[model samples]
Target: MPRNDAPDDQAPVASSPPTRLALIVRGGWEGHHPVAATELFLPVLRESGFEIRIEESPDVYADAGVMRDVDLVVQCMTMSEISREAVFGLRDAVAAGTGLAGWHGGIADSYRGSSDYLQLVGGQFATHPSRAPEDRPGDERDNFLPYRVEISEAGREHPITAGVGDFELTTEQYWVLHDDLIDVLATTTHPVQPYHPWHRPIVSPAVWTRHWGEGRIFVATPGHTPEVLEQAPVRTIIERGLLWAARTPSE
Candidate 1:
């Protein structure tokens, strides 16, 4: 007894508009090459129809009006302290539907003094254990090692991980303290080493997403240097993750 057609009084639904604005806040420890790392994705973001705004300071987070209007915020700061005003502004903005996304130490390791920031990020960087050379006890420059990143079953089906297979890379395998609510997409296992406490294979999330109020949070932990970001899988994951976090429609 149901009619096949819609009633004449019903109005047509409108399609969601394309993502318009994005803010990239980059600064803090130069070791991560925050500026260069963020620049690598500029082209892709532009091509995807975003008007990007780049900032070298965290003060931008304090701009409540600007924060409220931006569709997405991509932070690239590392080990920096955020002002109380900036912290509160950012927290409130994201809670009100502005998406937040970042990679490496930018989101995870930043603002060690702020628990509110950490709660929004859903994780914290504990340590990046390096392979110390036995011959050179004092020289510890090259601490990075090659490791494999395995995609989770959920990731294999997710839009961000589409066409992405498990990949290997020579970089810092981050040991992160993460929230229980995070939906883990991929992970890496830490090998037993003299520098680390875990003797057995300890797995950690390499990519994940968490929800804070109405906003979405995305984090990818593999980018320690620019070379790491050049890897096909790493680049793909980051690009996709950025779009996903921004609430953009992904084809």
Candidate 2:
């Protein structure tokens, strides 16, 4: 973990202004509300010294020159498609060590029709434990309802949740299914509701991360609704996750 004189692996050292971040956002699977999601994070990112360059469409991938300066990519796209050239441009940028971080469908559920894309990011949202018939409306109790989150022993100490405590949310708890092993950050076990047919117990991951070549990757499942983003714990988890994913491992 030796320190580098430069900010990025290939870029020259800069002693003046902080690093600039290019946020690539597109409307994908309108369910996630791309505009709302991306906008929710702008002020926070700017406060952290990020220089934001926004693109309303994923078509920005068509231009490689624009991709070169981005140190980190905040993807808000949902299920959608971009040209093969665009995909390659993004993949190449991250592979070269530019950080790629995103949550929900923007990074994982995106390109559902393209297995190649899913394979690259790792993990997908297969189901929501509390959304079944009996669990309908989920923790519909209220917006601030408290719930318990179980931390993954494997990633308990990662930067994303290092000092963060176990938490709860009123949002629909997500149950993720993936063959790729992830460094799960936190989880919430669902106690079978009286109406839930299955007697077996269930566990759901709320936040997690996967490794991809030179880039650090992250995934969080609690963002099913817009209000979820406003929750203190949820917002904190996403902010750190993005920074954790984009940072290069030191020598």
Candidate 3:
């Protein structure tokens, strides 16, 4: 995912930005509000100068011609199955330089049966710690607890998180299982509360990026609901991430 930087001695040229294509693949559990969630960013994608195409299925991945020309793939499918051909097409496209980006379970928790797909994204949603039954007595709201999302030192310099200070939110704070290949930008700590099984606090990556072959991958663990995605900071970060994960012609 290295940028093809031009030589320092190259002359600067003034030209309009090229129009790029963005493929939005969204569908899965209704609880995630996939349609409404992805629609939140349609205008932003257009404003960013991308010609967008919408797909409610991952089957589009099997269309090699379409995938080969896409500049970015914004997936929102969760807990769904993908065919072997589709998976290979997706992997090849990304490796050949098609950017992939998503938030929450859309990209992170998708295609559970596909090991290769899981490995490409570099992370998966584990569980969101919930309050003990005694704490709220039969209420499902136990999972929504206040937590702080802290920006790491490296985040201070990354374009996606620079100048964004630590923020607090009362939502489904995800506990993600990830690999060492990802460059972590921000994190959230799950404190050991009374009645909780874990003996010590657990720190999970809140935001991260991965470089796979010639492509860039971006994931943010927030955006459980449309309300969370509407938050000022959250919206800004996700918008920047979509742009950052797009493939450039030079690449």
Best by TM-score: 3
Q: Model 1 — which ten-residue stretch has the worst lDDT?
A: 134-143
- Residue pairs in steric clash, candidate 2? 1-251, 2-251
State which candidate has the highest lDDT. Answer: 3
Instruction: Give the alpha carbon lDDT tens digit for every residue of 77-114 in model 1.
Output: 99988999999999888888888988999888999999
Question: Which tens-of-lDDT digit does each residue in 1-251 have in candidate 3?
Answer: 98678787885878978889999999998777899999999999999889999999999999999998899999998889999999989999998899999998899889999998989999999898887667555554778778899999998899999989999888889999999999999999999988788899999999999988999999999988899999987888888999999998677
Instruction: Give per-residue CA lDDT, model 2, range 61-180, as digits (tens).
Output: 657788776777888887778777777777777766667777766776776776656666767766554444543444443222245876678656787887778776665555566654
lDDT (C-alpha, whole model) for all candidates: 0.86, 0.70, 0.90
Candidate 2: residue 112 Cα off by (Å):
0.7
| Candidate 1 Cα misplacement greater than 4 A, ranges | 1-19, 135-141, 248-251
Local lDDT at 238 for model 1: 91
Error of 3 at 16 (Å): 4.0
Error of 1 at 178 (Å): 1.0
Candidate 2 accuracy as lDDT:
0.70
TM-score of each: 0.88, 0.79, 0.91
Q: Give the clashing residue pairs of candidate 1, or none.
A: none
